[model samples]
Target: MWILISFWVIALAAVIATIKYRKPLLLTVPFFAMLGFLVVQIAMVPMPFWETVRFVFSLR
Candidate 1:
């Protein structure tokens, strides 16, 4: 199962760090983009998990 609890924790930490350090907002944008990409890749909700489905049906 795709898990996001840890991601949320890390994101929260990043927010805290940004507040403390005053980093540029652009920095967080990339971080969130990457996170979204990984979440989609792991969850396989948009696609199958590398299970190679055949397009054509064959006679048994």
Candidate 2:
């Protein structure tokens, strides 16, 4: 999805910037990348509890 692509683009840009700037913050790139993944997952999928409740209620 577009959201995932944009998140990766921004993350890549941040990594490039960190490299060019030679800042210590570059060390956190992995964490930021993981956080981006988490954001995408949260955006794309329903939470397990919500899905379970939806299915349970729909069965009536």
Candidate 3:
């Protein structure tokens, strides 16, 4: 999907910008936050995707 592609492009841009200019908190913080989110998701590897979605949503 184009949306997915664009999302990745934006994420890549953030990473590149962070690398090029290490002084921007706006770019660096979100990049690390997203990376942390992915790490947590990876830790949930044993759960099914639907169950993970349900469990996470149920918390809020």
Top model number, TM-score: 2
lDDT of 2 by residue, 1-60 (tens): 886687677778777888899886875776677777765655566667567556656995
TM-score of 1: 0.41
Stretches of candidate 1 off by over 4 Å are 25-60
RMSD of every prediction: 8.7, 7.4, 8.9
Candidate closest to the true structure, highest lDDT: 2
Task: Sort the candidates on lDDT, descending order.
Answer: 2, 3, 1
lDDT of 1 at 7: 57
- TM-scores of the models, in the given order? 0.41, 0.42, 0.41
Q: Residue pairs in steric clash, candidate 2? A: none
Q: How does model 2 score by TM-score?
A: 0.42
Candidate 2 lDDT at 39 equals 59
